[model samples]
Target: MPRNTLIAGGVLVVLGVISYVASAFASVTALIPAFLGVVLVICGLIARKKPMLGVHVALVVALLGLVGTFMNVLKIGEVFAGTAERPLAVVVSAITFVLLLIYIALGVRSFVAARRWKKADAISQA
Candidate 1:
């Protein structure tokens, strides 16, 4: 592996581990998607030499989803850190839902891209 790929993979592994651990203590389960995002990032880095455009698109969308989820979680955590309040929770939850919609859209796009890449690969191999 190239140095950059190694570093990127290592970062992704760390991100996955951190998100997994954090989810255990947080109200948000965003960690699960974050873990998936990290895996996609690692896959993307590994496949960089293969020129699979769809896989590359999947990686990019996963990365974006990860970042957006991270931000959404931060906002929720901030709003609920010291409160026993229900209103803040409701507001934050609403915001999270909206962000999730964006994440889902990107996720769908990524899957479509990955499927295209898979078909292309099959044709090439045949």
Candidate 2:
């Protein structure tokens, strides 16, 4: 991994660890999505050198993950407590889902391209 990717991945790995810990406590479960966002951002940054489209998609997925987490908190608050449902949560969730689909598509495309590149390089060397 490049310097930036290694750095970002390290951060994400940390965040993921924190999130998993937080899940063990009721008070911290709500923050899980935000932590997931941090991880996604790390993944995106790490993959930046691989493909332009994939990078963009990763960034978007990170943003959506943030929104999804926020929505999850809101939904939980509304259902369990007296808090009213926040429309923002719904909006964010929708956007996040769409972005996730795009991210997966880009990831697959990048994987295919990378494979092709390796094959071409190997053939040329031979």
Q: Choose the strongest candidate by lDDT.
A: 2
The TM-scores, one per candidate, come to 0.36, 0.43
State each model's CA lDDT, in order.
Answer: 0.50, 0.51
Residue 78 lDDT in candidate 2 = 58
Residue-by-residue lDDT tens digits, candidate 1, 1-126: 122333443454555455545546454443444445455555556556654553554446555654654544545544556543433333433443444355446546756887899999999999
Clashes of each: 0, 0
After superposing candidate 2 on the true structure, give the runs of residues whose Cα lies further than 4 Å from its correct spot. Answer: 1-33, 45-86
lDDT tens digits, residue span 3-83, model 2: 333343345445545554544643443344345556566655656555454455555655556455554544654544656
RMSD of candidate 1 to the truth, in angstroms, is 9.3
Judged by lDDT against the true structure, how good is candidate 1? 0.50
